[model samples]
Target: MTDLLRLDHVTKLFPVGGFFSRRSMKAVDDVNFALSADKPEIFAIVGESGSGKSTLAKMMLGNEVPSSGQLSFDGTDVAAIRGRAAREAFMAKVQPVFQNPFEAFNPLTKLDEYLFATAHRFLGASNRGAREAAADAALQRVGLSLSEVRGRYSHELSGGQLQRIAVARALIPNPKLIVADEPVSMVDASLRMSIVNLFRELRDELKVSIIYITHDLATAYYISDRVIIMQKGKVIESGDARTVLEHPTQPYSIALKGAVLPPDPAAASAIIRQRQVVAG
Candidate 1:
C-alpha cells in the first residue's frame, strides 16, 4: 500500500522577542510519519502542552510552513500547493476538525451554513437543492440529520452535537484524511465516547485516515492503531497503541500513562505501583 501522506524530518520554528535579540522557538523538531492510503486507521499523536502536536497539524494542513524538511500528500510537495485552486484541491482531500467545536463554527451564523458552504465550495454542488442534499448526506455520516442541525446557533447545541456537526462539515468534502486536534476534550464525559466511537466508524466504514491529536491517553488507547508520544517538540515514544501504552519505554510516555485518572481507587493504586516500577 502506498502512503497517502508523508512527513519527512519536518520542523517548524518561530522567532520571539526583539529584532536584534530574537530567539527561535522550535515548535516541531524533525518529526516523521507516514499514513497508508490502503490502510485506513486512526493514527494518534499524544503529547502534553507545548509539545508541537498542534504545530505539526497546522504544518500538515499547509496553514503553516515548515522551517525545514518536507510534507507531501500523494507524492506532491505540500509547501508548493499555493493559490486558491491548488489549496482547494488540497483541502478537498484533507480537512480539519479543530479543538473547539464552538469556535469552529460562527456563533452569529447558522450551523448549516458551514456545511452548505463546504458542499458548494469544495464539492462543487451547484444550486440550493444540490448543496442541501450534500449537506444532509454529510450530516447522516456523522450520525446526525439536517432537520436537527439546520439553522441552529453554536450555543444551542450540546458540545457533542457541535463536535459531530463539525465532523459532518469536514466530511462534506469527502476528505481522505482528517486532522482532529483534541476533538472531544471539551465535551461532557458521556458524550466523549460517542465522538470517539464516531472516529472508529469513520475509519472502518468511510475508509478515512484520521490524525487524532490528543492528550487523553484512555480514549487514545481505545481508538488508535498506532501512536506517537511527543515532548518539547520531539517524538519521545511511538509504536502500536496498546503495546506502547502498556509498556512505555520513555520516561515521558510513562509519566503520561501514569497521569491517566482511573475510575476506581483500586485501579488507581495498581496504576501507581506500575508507574513506580516503570519509573525505577
Candidate 2:
C-alpha cells in the first residue's frame, strides 16, 4: 500500500535575534514518520510545550514550510503544492481541528455557517438544500445535527459542543486525515472522553486517519494505536502506544509518564515506584 503521508528528515528553522547576530533555532529537527494510505488509525504525538509537535503539525498542514528535507502526502511533495486550487485539493484530504473550541469560530456568527461553508466549499454543495443536507450528515457523525445549531452562536454552545461542531465541520470535507492539536484540553473534564471517543469512531467507522497531538498521556494511551514522544524538538521514544507508555525507556518519556497522576489513590504509590524504577 502507498503511504498516506511521509515526513523524511524534516526540519524547520526560524531566524532569531537582530540581523547582526542572527542565528537559526531549530524548532523541529529531522522528524520522520509515515501513515499508510490503505490503513486508517489514530497516531499520537505526545509532548509538552515547545516540543515541536505543533510546528510539525503546521509543516504537515502546509501552513509553514520546512527548511530542509521532504514532506509528502499520498506520494506528492507538499512543497510542490501551490496555487489556490492545489492548496484546496490538498486540504480536501487533510483537515485540522484546533484547541480552544470557543475561539475557533466568530462569536456572532451562526454555528451552522461554518458547517455549511465547509460543505459548500469542499463537497461542492451547489445549492442551499444540498449544503444543509451535507452539513446535517456531517454533524450526525459527531452526534449533532444542524437543527440543534442552526441559528446558534459560538457563545451559545458549551466548549465540548463547539468542539464537536468543529470536528463535524472537518468531516464535511470527508478528509482522509485530521490533525487535531490538543483537541480535548479545553473541554470540560466530564466531556473530554466523549470527544476522544468520537475520534475513535471516526477512525473505526469513517475510516479516517487522525494525527492526535497532545500532552496528556492518559488520553493518548486510551485512544492511540501508535505513539511518538518528543522533547525539545526531537523524537525520544516511539512504539505501540500501550507498550511505550507502560514501559517508557527514555528519561524524558519516563518523566512524562511519572507526571500522570493515577486516578486511584491506592495505585498511586505503586505507579510512582514503578516510574522511579523506570527513570533510574
Candidate 3:
C-alpha cells in the first residue's frame, strides 16, 4: 500500500525566555508515523495536554511548519507548498476537524454558508446551484441535509450537530486524510460516542484515513485501529489498539490504562465508595 503520510525525523521547537536566556522548548522531537493511502484506517494519537499532540496535528494540516526533518503527504513535501495553487491542492486532499465546533464556524454567518463556500472553493462549483447541490450531498453523508442546516445560526444547533456540519464541510473537499484534534471533547457525553462512531464509518464506508487525536483512552480504544501513546512529546507505546490497551508495555501506558474509568456504573460506584472510605 502506498503511504498517505510520512514523517521522517520530524521535530518542532519554539524559542522561550529572553534572547539572552538561550533556551527553547521542543514540542515534537523526531516523531514518525505513516498512514497508508490504499488502506483507510483510524490511526489515533493519544496524549495529555502539552504533549505536542495538537502541534503534530497542526503540522499535518499544514498550519504549522516543522523545525527539522521531512513531512510528506502523498510524496510531496508539505513545507514546500507555498503558492496559493499548491496550498489549495494540498488542502483539497488533507482537511481538519478542529477541537471545538462552536469556535470552528462564525456565529453571525449561517452554518450552511461554510458548507457551500467549501464546495465552491474546493469542488470548483462556480455557480450557486452547483454549490448548493454539492453542499447538500456532503451534508447528507453526515446524516444532515441542507434543509436542516441551512439558514441556521451556530447557537441554534447542538454541539454534535455543529461538529457533524464541520465534518461535512471537510468532506466537500473529498479529502483523503482528516486530522481531527480532539473533535468531540466539548461535545456532550451522550453525543460523544455518536461522533466517534461516525469516524469509524468514515474510515470503513467512505475510505478516509483519519489522524484521530485525543486524551480519552476509552474513545480511542473503541474507535481506533492503531494507537500511539504520547508522553511529554514522545511516543511511549505504539501498536494495534486491542493489543496495546489490553497489554500495555510502557509504564506510562499502564498508568493511563489504570486511569480509565469503567463504563459500568456499579464498578464506578464501587471505586468511588472505596475512595470515600479511604478519605475518612
C-alpha local distance difference test of each model: 0.92, 0.93, 0.91
TM-scores, each model vs. reference: 0.94, 0.95, 0.95
Error of 3 at 209 (Å): 0.3
Model 2 Cα lDDT, one tens digit per residue, 1-280? 3999999999999899998999989999899999999889999999999999999999889899999999999899998897998899999999999999998899888988888888888988999999999999999899998899999999988999999999999999889999999999999998999999999999999999999999999999999999999988899898899999999999999888977888988788887788688889
Query: Worst 10-residue stretch by lDDT in candidate 1?
Result: 252-261
TM-score of 1: 0.94
Give the top-scoring candidate (lDDT): 2
Q: How well is each residue in 1-280 modelled by candidate 3, as lDDT tens digits?
A: 3889999888999898997997888898889888888899999999999999999999998989999999999999999998998999999999999899999988999998998889878989999999999999988888899999989999999999999999999999999999999999999988988889899889998999999999999888899999999988788789899899989999999878866779889887876787688799
Q: Give the TM-score of candidate 2.
A: 0.95
- Summed over model 2, clashes come to 0
User: What lDDT score goes with residue 51 in model 2?
Assistant: 96
**Stretches of candidate 3 exceeding 4 Å from the true structure:** 269-280
Candidate 3 clashing pairs, residues 3+ apart or interchain? none
Q: Model 2's lDDT to the true fold? A: 0.93
lDDT of 1 at 188: 90
